[model samples]
Target: MQKTHCIIPFEKNRNFTGRESELTQLEEMLFAGDQTTKVAVFGLGGVGKTSLVIELVHRIRKNHENCSVLWIPAINLESLHQAYLDVARQFGIRGWEEDSADVKRLVQEFLSRESAGQWLVVFDNADDINMWVGTPTEQGTKRLIDYFPRSKLGCIVFTTRDRKTAVTLAQKNVVEVREMSEDVATIMLQNCLIDPDLVNNKTDTSSLLKELIYLPLAIVQASAYINANRIPFSDYLSLLADQEEDVIDLLSEEFEDDGRYQNVKNPVATTWLISFEQIRQRDPLAAEYLSFMACIDSKDIPRSLLPRGQSRKKEMEAIGTLDAYSFVTRRLANDALDLHRLVHLSTRNWLNLRNEWDDRANTALHRVEDMFPRPKHENRALWMSYQIHAQCVLTSTKDREKESKEWYSLASRIGECCLSTGKYQESESWIRQTLKLKEEVLGKTHPETLVTMNNLALVLDRQGKYAEAETINRQGLHWL
Candidate 1:
């Protein structure tokens, strides 16, 4: 029996979250005695697909001594070919010794044989479908996916975010990875903590887990923040509960993950930005819609809000382009859309880095405000859905008053509706939050901040807090 030939770049992530079922399912597919099994695990970036594959390989290595495991990356041809060279060096391929022939093909030919034994080869992050298959659209010389060694004695697994790529590479044998379960996510958060006792408060730990929406990468990142800053989960949650900048700053802060490449400094943003750039290059229209979606609430995004072309056909095609990569998901109930919150944040950060956030943010703010009616009795259904999306944009805008007047107006209207609906406390909370932000951004003397202060005092008076209301009024008058 030969030892495994697996030579992955990084050590296994000790903090791996729950993917037991996924690992079992994938393992079964690999060992099903199909030497040419082309199985794929596909999902959004940082969704733990790679971790699942790595765990499967680990199990196979430990339990099956006769099996040979080869892990290669398909991030690009250069990386793939370098991996091939490593394989050649590892296996002592004949022609590769003197570098007499093309080592890549030699390595492929060497592995694509019965004598290769039962092997499980993993192509992690096989993102570019055409890059593998060498389609006409691909720049320079195209290479068919057959470049990888294929043998009846070997099995192949691909991890990709592109659903179409998964289909192309694996046919019907594909598993769609999803976010971690709440319990598993909590466990991961606990594991990543430098001091487990720091999370002694189960309630706070559980609350932070839910706030992260049970995503493994985010859970890990939050834990990294906690460990590095020596802060509690509750404090980090407060930042997340605050402005978008807080969330952005928290996520944009980089930490090491064994499963990630070394150059990938920021896990959440850098990982997704790769796909975003690809989509932008492939179809600018899809890119535009993605940026637009990033600006709104990830849930219940209406088709009417998208950038539609001359015909509905064009609109569906644009949406399909995004769907192909799983960047956004469609909600059948309301015929709306939703996306991963991290994806939403990463997209905005992408724009902010490129200096395009203001353009896209302002566009979405104006459209949501003008298209959706104020929250009122006539059409509460439409207004409710529309207002949710509008609020998403409003909250992301910083204190730059001139750049966000439309958003401010919309927020004011929504605040009024909250008061009329006997949501006095809710209205007061909203007014106070905005007033604080405006004061920070526009200063107390700024006209908008004064108006916000007046509204906050009114809401306080309405709530029968006359003394507090008087103090707020006096502050506004003094600022004047």
Candidate 2:
């Protein structure tokens, strides 16, 4: 038998993803002084916090033979009490079951003993501070943190979505588990796909991983879908882009994880919906801001674009709420904020399920359209930040027909900016795209459509593609 008879059940497959740095950090914390023994791994739901902690569990059992380990589910007070009782039984503490003595208090004192050797206890999925610490009510007497056994002989690891609770529980020892690195994501994807592909397909595999946003849960889910349907990755990618509904459809399809995750079921979207609902309930503004962000691009969103001015302090604090939970990362250099791509899609889908997708999306588009600068040479620097965001938002939308018309102007402005900056190919592509949209949305002979056609021909001519340019100019002449 191993040293930890009461450890969390390790998955038989034993194929864990990245976080070598995190695992090492955890190992160091286990042996460090009192200031570091107890560590909290906190991040957005489905960001692999639990999986990383589970890996830590397996490592502990292997490296520290004298260490005692326990897994506790702190979903609520009752589960916590039950976990404490179970551990008490494992340690064989005297009279732990008796109503005469408090089981929690006794379990606490026993595990705090120096004889306990190097002990580690993991409290998984502690998503709520109120549940652990108990909000101000009659039951708020003792928090779960208060009952934890603290000793140099023992260490406690917590996995939570609540940063405040994490700070209160683990103090300075916190591991903010972010998304898996691209290389790690690629490895996970290669491992996840059941079907064999040609050796030359690695580039496509990397592309698909990027499309899945490098989130481990999303990557795993996509791979499972591919394997289950026996479909090629290319097909899944095509389906994924069919519409937001398709992405939602894929995300909501349930799969069995073979009991690896305790209560987190397979649907990647559902796992995040729980967090979405919680965020909505706790802070509606933050939730709205998230919804708005989903409408924008997922990267390098400047604080300048969000609601601002004299209320800047209040707005920043609201955004900070998201930063605290690892939903968005605030870049220190330019104060730009980036959202996880899957999280962005999931947020839109979360709203979609409620039939709020179009209204919300339209609102987001209008926000961007309102904020976007008109095509002018002086504002070129300002357009740089908004360029990618506009393209991302425009591309993510499935229904180009229902999109706000202002997007055309935005496109033209960005295209003109691209032209002036010597990005000829990009400029040509955007001009051609908007010209086509203008022909479709406004009839072929509409003055605006002719103007767009002329603009496209000009850019095409500028690119020295005379044949295409002459062809566009001829079509315009025929329409006029």
Candidate 3:
């Protein structure tokens, strides 16, 4: 595949992909003669947070022609301060440097002043939490957020991966971004790639593409690679199926013309690495937690189940650190703490490249199992909790095929845990759900599912529910 470097500006005429609702919500927030509202767009990296923000700016500029738009990337405190300086420069604030701090204060005050109607400031990618905790201007990134004066005349929007950051900044005004639907993905692919023919014929190609989870960065990388290589979409699919590492390697290849960004080392990979390395350096425990998380599927992780070495408290702290950096998201029970699949992939890639893949995975597995559900009648709640944790730990792991036995063991153990809890109905329900998913994804006869079925039947038999147990056993017998 040819190296791709320069990121072309998104086509204005092209249909904006996957954010119609978000745009509409933003429009509502900022609609009509300057009612000051702060909105935030936040999600995992590469979910197109920046793209969405850029597009929103264009829309706001075009439709609300009178409104001034100011954008600042808050990756760190200095960049945020520079943004203040830039805002000062834009306003032509003379002698602003005479009293820099006072000038900044005035700028904030002016922006929020009743006269500053129809102006919007977008704080893009404000991921760092320290930015929020300290004094808004003097200590950390928090000051910039605080600096944005609350005025009915002005509006602000922030984009970040950390839910906590969004809460700290915009609170109720935050919007969570999910993966794009097929239609949006198709539109995005069509617009981004060089070859129209391949996109037009994206029947089988689309199916293969879905496995990459429809993340904007992944789609962009895939489209760019396919266009540059002139490879048939089918061949590309074959390479992808053959090895994920191969696809990542191909993505990593750099284009000489584009210098760094255009090279095969995809933007997704590059930016993710920077975040990963930072987490590792600043918070090794969180880094370890993230590395373990990389071993599993990222879409839904249960916090109770994550591998947290010997110190449970320490693990929670580590998770907090990761959460602050927007590396990991805390779903907090309602949906099981979900991690972005792209983050999962990037983390695994980082671990494998650094030669810590096995160590991380094994440590995760060990610590996770240690926290697994224990079996006892009275402590059924505890058992169920542990069961959920173990499932999350196992599910979050990577290379399920290689760890088939471990998967089977974990699944079976969960089933056993459920049975022992005497929540027989709940046990049956849990086993049935696992079996249904396992049957569809892993197959009906996959040892894991079969074992779970047998366990479920055993639970039924133990409860003296012979008819139900017999029915389940009959099905398993056929599989055997």
Candidate 4:
């Protein structure tokens, strides 16, 4: 499955592949029936998270006709608030204004009642962690979630990219997800093609498909282009292999404009970039957070690792900015905190393409290299904060893909510097992290993605984890 799996009929033709296990898990959690279940399914973008949930919601609606299934993409606090009000409207709450606290109270009251039985609410993409930082939208969806009735009849599901945020909200209920299977990817490609029989050409098609790592998003996009252009599957493969710009161009087609999702562009990458631009315009602090994220770990960004140099007011404002944009999310698990991988990836790619980022990529990398692990015996809280900064810095730029290789060379020099200074762990981590970003944004099939992949993989192999090293080797080969 590629990015094109997001297309409706195209994806449906393949009969909805992957995520069966996740669906079953959700069903069990929602149907267990004793306590009000607060479950969260989280993972990277394009890993079939939303699709699986959509399928689950459809099944629940069809089977349990009495229950009201509400789907809300809490893209931001305002969006989340709107979704809450929409739910209220569903219950025939007339005269309910979106900003009215009275409407919110009523929503809480209704859900609290025993009669609101077997209802399920999905807070999809509620990954923005900024929601909890300050003021915290006391009157809107956050309040709604906090106030939602705790009853066996009520079930709440949140899909997010931030594991920390999900865990914080649902605790042990968080379920992490991954990409689709190879078999499913092949089926999806075949079904999406104009002539499905062409999919059987095991030589070039299979080879190209494997290069995409069988990611649902990439596969779907590739399939749509191949079918739409009436080109041999091998030619499409050759295009992806030809140049970084070509792959980016190929992924940016308008394939998923199937009515309901008119706003979301095709290739998944561009659609995600709009959200990135939104964050930048609506919230500079959040945009900065995203820029910081581009140069970081790209996963496992702990809240405690964030920079608190800002005064409490500034901190709150920054957190609020991110929450309002739905760019950074936190999962509250009694006390634990986590960030989403998808948010990180989207932000990194967004920054990578911005000609402006090239100017600061080196400085950002140096900042991260300077602060990792913190000074002396760090507490878990401080460790988390440092890691988050490190991740943000790592993700903020792509020295490898710049018009000049100076940034990449600078990164290499820094890594070697760290290594010579007996900070081999930091050196290796920085190199590997930078390499991964280059591969994703600069093109895994391009020299930059491939070279960094090789450098990082070899570094990893030297430190053991040969299996991990081998995986990187194969990833680089896809570029070849």
Highest TM-score: which candidate?
1
lDDT of each residue in 1-480, candidate 3, tens digit only: 111111112334353577889778778777444456878888766777777777887787777666777776677767666766777776765566775355557677767665665577877767776665656544423354456677776777888876667878877888877778887888877776677567677676587468667877777777667778888777777766755677666556543222122212445665678668767866787887787667655655666666545687777678777765556556655535656655676788898889887677766667666665546677666555555556655654565433444554555567667576566776676576667667767777878678778877887887799998899989988998
- Over 1-480, each residue of candidate 1 has an lDDT whose tens digit, in order, gives 334576766666676767888888887787676457899999877777888888788888888777788888888878877887888888878877664567766877877877877787889989987687755443443364756677777888999988878998999999999877777776787788888886678898888877776777777777787888899877888988887777777777788777777755645656788899888877688888988888888877888877656677767777887887777888988888887677887898899888988888887777777876766688777766676677677866665633455755677767766776778987886777667667766788999899888888888899899999999999999999
TM-score of each: 0.79, 0.76, 0.65, 0.60
Winner by TM-score between candidate 4 and candidate 1: 1
The segments of candidate 1 whose C-alpha lies over 4 angstroms from its true place after superposition are 1-4, 33-35, 97-100, 136-144, 310-314, 321-326, 373-380, 391-480
Best by lDDT: 1
lDDT of all predictions: 0.78, 0.76, 0.67, 0.62
- In model 2, which runs have C-alpha deviations exceeding 4 angstroms? 1-4, 34-36, 92-102, 134-140, 162-165, 193-200, 331-333, 362-366, 373-375, 387-480
lDDT of 2 by residue, 387-432 (tens): 7877766665557533448777667777877787778899888887
Candidate 2 TM-score to native: 0.76
Angstrom error of the Cα, residue 120, model 2: value is 0.8
| Prediction 4 TM-score vs. true | 0.60
Clashes of each: 1, 0, 18, 49
Better of 3 and 4 by lDDT: 3
